[model samples]
Target: MEGNMNYFEIFKDVSVVFFIAIPPWLALRKYLKNYLNRAFLTIFFITYIIATLLTQNVFPFILVVLCFYFAIKMKDNFEVLYYLRPIKEKKTEIILYCLFFRFIIYIINVFYASLLEYVGIKVKAQDIYEIFLNAGWIKVIFLFAMTVVFAPIVEEFTFRHILYRGLSKKIGKQLSAALTSFLFALIHYNLAGFVSFFGIGIYNCYLYEKYGYRAAVVNHFIFNFISVLLILLIKIFNIPTVMT
Candidate 1:
């Protein structure tokens, strides 16, 4: 039988709006399928949505950071972090492996930037298809919130926490991680990103397998920040610092 094609093929029919219901659907499927579980999942979804929307500002960020801090502080007794279990042990080997991969991808990004320039897209450090350039402070901040804050939480939860866990239940750990990482890369929905983030997904899965969600979050946050900083340096200072 013919299998499903690439990520884009599987997702071409999926609209952006479909994602709005993802959290609830996921909670239902993963945590609450039975009557009791379903009831809890429904409430959890509602609460998660409300909390995220209501605390879209610094408050939410503060709360999340504090949670991370508490987890670090309480270390052994952090029950909540257990919710993101199967997190891998901290290991330098994988971080170094990811670092080497990222460095190569940085060169790829620069070349990709050259291609974008060919087609009249400005390949700066930051620009969404080079269409939404740094218009102003307000717009920049909005982009930051969407890409950094909202995206990391939601995407990691869905792609890694839920899907990774689901797949791990049925397959070998290594195989499930590879497949989930591939799906995560595919769902990004762009040729450039499709080329770029697959390895990132792999690294994230490695982190999940090693240090858990906290490591994933930390790696993710650092990756974004470094990318942004590199872009800004490239565009504003005319310096080309590659991804580390």
Candidate 2:
């Protein structure tokens, strides 16, 4: 295993990933222009990582809530979700169907979790639980916003609207969706969350393919809401599980 990195890893390693990746990304930008803005992504990654580490205690919650507020407002007025799908589907139908897909994903996650445990994929449940102990109301509220609002808007825009639509033109949709999902999961920096989040990516892709951004966003929201709620519920209720 690689040695665990310190704050320098967040600072320098993150910079290296982009600085090295930039030239090829720019060269390919002519092809995948709409997929990612090179400048914005580099800025976003750098700013986000540094800010995330620095703002760890509580203030970041305030910023995330702001992101949620703006996302909801834009989605309501601009109809960004409507434009990204097939020619005829209504946003209402897309959201409902997406929830249906989200329910299915929850079942899949449970089964996969069992399989991982059976094979002795040891993960420190207590470590994750401690993050919750540090969490106060601000963090809880932020978790809700992160799940039910912010994630839906950002992830659907990233994976469904941008990643899938851009890549499918070159590779087939099948390969593009799978690869994008894998990459998406890999970026989250959690060993235990990889499978469940990858499952999220696949389900989000399906929602996008079947309907549009509306469907994808709705599914993403449902998945996050459920996951966050479960974690909160376990801790809140003081259930005697391995988590703490």
Q: Highest TM-score: which candidate?
A: 2
Per-residue alpha-carbon lDDT of candidate 2 for residues 1-244, written as tens digits (9 for 90 to 100): 2454577456544543332223223323343344568787677555654654453313233433343344455453343335343435476676666577667765765666667778997654423355654589787776566456755665555566666767888998889889888877765556566766787788778767766666666777776676667678877887665321
Question: In model 2, where is the ten-residue run with the lowest total lDDT?
Answer: 19-28
lDDT of each: 0.57, 0.59
- Candidate 1 lDDT, 1-244, residue by residue in tens: 2455656434543433234234334443432343356577678656655655543323334334444454455563444466455435544654565566667776776677578879986533322423223345576666566566655655665667667767788997778888877877665555555546776777778777667775676566556666655544554564544322
TM-scores for candidates 1 onward, in order? 0.58, 0.64
Separately for all candidates shown, the number of backbone clashes (residues 3 or more apart, or on different chains) is: 7, 0
Q: For model 2, state the Cα shift of residue 4 in Å.
A: 1.4
Residue 22 of model 1: what lDDT? 49
- Pairs that clash in candidate 2: none
lDDT of 2 at 138: 86
Q: What is the lDDT of candidate 1?
A: 0.57
